[model samples]
Target: MKVIVVFGVFFFFSIAAVMAQPANRQVFWRDLQSRYEADSNRVVRVYLDKFGYFYPVNAIPIDKQLFLFPAREHNVNASTISSANLYAYFHANQTAQNALLNYYQVSQTGNFDRDYKKVEEQELRQISRQVHRLVENLQAKNIIFLVHGFNVTDPVSRYVFFEHSVSQKGYDTKIKPLYIEVYWDGLTSVSGTDLLAIWKHAQNNTRWVSLALRDLMRHLDDRLPFTIVTHSLGASVATGALFNTSSKWLADGNTHDVDSIASSIPAPVDVPIKLGMIVPAIPGGLTFVDFNHRSPDITTVANNIVGIAIGYNPKDYATSKAFFSTSFGATTLGCDHENELRNVSLALRGCGYSLAQVQQMIYPVQFTTPNIALGLQDHDFQKYMEDDVDFSLFLAKLFNE
Candidate 1:
């Protein structure tokens, strides 16, 4: 019995020793930049930070070392890449530069749409002009926007990981559309008491971010195409933004500001727009119904969208458990809803949408947890994007040429 016990203890320790090593081969951002620096062709990355916008509009490289939290303050930064010094590539191109600068400027003005700054009117017009220029530069009709989920408090880290993962999957070489990342404070430290705070933050941030996105869309040439891809809590944000699409705002067709010139524009067409939600951490119930009367519901958003794809893994307990335990007591959309379409139909009917419309727009992509021995691997972005997990293939198919 002593010999058996000794062998069991040795086996346990051996397993622990092997697992103690780092899971991912940590690829430094600098190293990744070096590989792309050959042409000295810089990618003008657009950042919209809601956490602490510490960086200024066209500020110097604050910190090069990558970590969890990068900066402090409430500002947005727009800068270009340069090969001579990859760390500080200031974009001189006025058109593209101005568009990015405008993004930062608009974000500084409070989270609500009603709190519009005087300068925001002119800045939004400038954004519309610059966005047109970007479309011409890229010569593509579709613009891809990536919305990240929780635990990524650092804008730099989120940008690095997202761009790196996209490149690794050959998205850059394949699709040449302009890419933008919506960075908000989706940060939460897991503790017994932290979940409630995190939930509230997510709800508030989603509303703000969604309004920001709606404003961005309103300003852009409505003729241009857009696709937003979101993961986890970002899925909630995206849904909230979609659900919160104001009928009055759409009817007004532009900002109500006296100084604004982009007013009276045509309402967005009910076609060609797409939203891809990956492992969304939102309540399944909220996706279709509008709690308010005569407000734009999921069907209203669906009418304007050509394609909608939602990716979820039934075994993502991290997402499922978090929402289930919350005060909301809501079941997450990420978990397997055996009657997902039925739920959609019922919700759609509540919003006055037919089952046929549900069939036309809603496409749910199901995934199983990867058969790995690692804990929490099911919820990790690295597992979804880096490893040869099925999610990667699903993404490829989702955005395939």
Candidate 2:
């Protein structure tokens, strides 16, 4: 009887030990770095600061053979520095890394390489032709530039979303997708102070982006039509940039000559922006002073331009409670937890527009759910995209019509 009892105790102890193993718990930086290094098709570069935390680096597809480097910086003020937060960041990175690897594989084995190379070579030869066409069409066309939201630790999400969205509407060749990813690798936690700090950092980063855009536009021989899309805290960043640009322009008597501006500013692409899309924008980020005094009247801005679409969902709990509470006064329940694209669609619908019209305006669409739940389940936008939601056709009708 004694021996049997002892054996039972031993069995229970072994089981508990197995359950407590590191692999069963959560993955951290070391595990992620190991997996990243082992990946062949995807390359992972780490930028480390004085602290142990690291930033992720990857390439964004620019042309067939060329890639734009998408660099991310870590938010040092993140609330939780625990193993769980590390796990979330790692999981996000893995998703992006996998997508890039798949892209590389497809590019190598399929016609992606051949087609892209052909396009590049053709583009090089027909630069003058394209330039001439652009100049001829320089009168005023609508162009939309998208800036991604916060907690986008992975570059793949942005690339996949952009690629799929652009491909859906055949804008892959016609429209230039200016993806301004301001990466401040924010830590996942439910702390308010930490979030505030991250928000401030994001605001600061906007100045750099603004300068870049201004510079990019100044050098362009022809200006194409343009719009700006910003999500989550990104809305704040975009607003900051716009406000700075407008202030600078006003200060300079609305002159486009920006040669004496700091070299850090991005050169402006010769693009004339006709519309601005503020999707479930965080209006709180703009203080009362800014809204009343400094900020441009978004409505007036829209009226003077082609159109402005404000995508919002009464069901988007996070945006409504956290972001919206800070931006706008009232917090309605209807727009809770809705994704960006869907919210944009709702905003358009509210303004008496049809789905088809929305689709004609924007291509390849994406939606995001609010991260109100505080757990592993909260960070699953990819899963939401993969679900059997007939968003493509629905979005097509909403934007294209």
Best by TM-score: 1
* Distance from true location, Cα of 327 in model 2, Å: 8.2
lDDT of 2 by residue, 159-213 (tens): 3564476456675445544332223232223344444434433332333334433
Candidate 1 lDDT over residue span 42-86, tens digit each: 223333323111122232232233222122312211111111111
How well does each candidate superpose onto the true structure, as a TM-score?
0.60, 0.40
* Global lDDT of each candidate: 0.47, 0.34
TM-score of 2: 0.40
Off by over 4 Å in 2: 1-144, 173-193, 219-222, 244-271, 274-281, 284-304, 322-324, 327-401
Off-target runs (Cα >4 Å) in candidate 1 are 1-56, 59-116, 122-130, 155-175, 190-196, 245-271, 291-302, 322-331, 337-341, 370-377, 386-389
Task: Tell me how many clashing residue pairs each candidate has.
Answer: 4, 56
TM-score of candidate 1 to 2 decimals: 0.60
